[model samples]
Target chain A: MYLAKIYVTYKPSILDPQGVVIKSALERLDYQGIESVTQGKYFQVQLSGADEAAVAKEVEAFVEALLINHNTETYTYDLTEI
Target chain B: MYLAKIYVTYKPSILDPQGVVIKSALERLDYQGIESVTQGKYFQVQLSGADEAAVAKEVEAFVEALLINHNTETYTYDLTEI
Candidate 1:
């Protein structure tokens, strides 16, 4: 088996409302020394019978095809044998 | 400036309850084709005046000290210049 860790984040120039809300929430909760927050999503996927290169290519395709909106968000992945 | 994208996930041998819950939720919400799901945390940090290596070191320390539990979770990061 293989494990794929994927990260999806907002494009640099785009605004992240979810992040802003979390930052405000943290400040309201009195978390000290916190300046800002930008949030993103992480997904850990388990695959069966796929080699590293195959899995990597599949993951890139998956992200591009469904997981992320390339114009607004970017994604990357790390794969490891299980 | 530098941007740090950190991904934190549950250790391999450990169970991921959040992931399980999300998987169930997705199924309930009529999202198809999800066999399983493992959830994780992602933090996008904007750093000023720090080089990539230094930011990497500081991020490691941050994750070790506060972001992740070494026994239960592991983290990796990607640094980008902006």
Candidate 2:
């Protein structure tokens, strides 16, 4: 088995209202100087019977096919042996 | 100015109920074989007059001080010149 860690975040040019809410929450809690907040998804996938390079390719394709909307979000991944 | 991207996540062993909710959501959206979902926070901070290494140290300290609950969460960062 291998561990595939993926991070998905909105494009820099996009407006993120949820991020805004979180930023305000942090500020209210006295976390000063926090200029912005961005909400994103982190996923840890367990792979079976796949090599690292192949898995990376497949995962990227998978995201492009179904997981992420490439128009609005971008994703990156780190694959590690388990 | 520098951009400090921070990711705060729960310890692996902890029970992630919100993650579970998201997992169910994905499944309902036809995302198959998603074993689990883990929720986390992502923040993009604009720093003033702090070098990469110094900003890293201070940000780590800031997370320890206010952002994360060390007992339940762990954090990491990537600093980039912007």
Which model scores highest in TM-score?
2
Q: What DockQ values do the models have? A: 0.27, 0.31
Candidate 2 on B1-82: residue-level lDDT in tens? 6777778888988887877775676666665445555667666766554466776776676667766888898878888877
Residue-level lDDT for B23 in candidate 1: 61
Task: Put down candidate 1 lDDT per residue, B1-82, tens digits, no spaces.
Answer: 7777778888879999977876676556654344567878898766654466776776566557666788999888887876
Off by over 4 Å in 2: A21-36, A69-71, B18-39, B64-66, B69-71
Relative to the unseen true structure, what is the C-alpha lDDT of residue A66 in candidate 1, on a scale of 0 to 100?
57
C-alpha RMSD of each candidate structure in angstroms: 5.9, 4.2
* Tens digit per residue, CA lDDT, model 1, A1-82: 7777888889889999977875566556544334556778899876664467776776676667656788899877888887
Question: Best candidate, lDDT-wise?
Answer: 1
Top DockQ prediction, candidate number: 2
Error of 1 at B32 (Å): 16
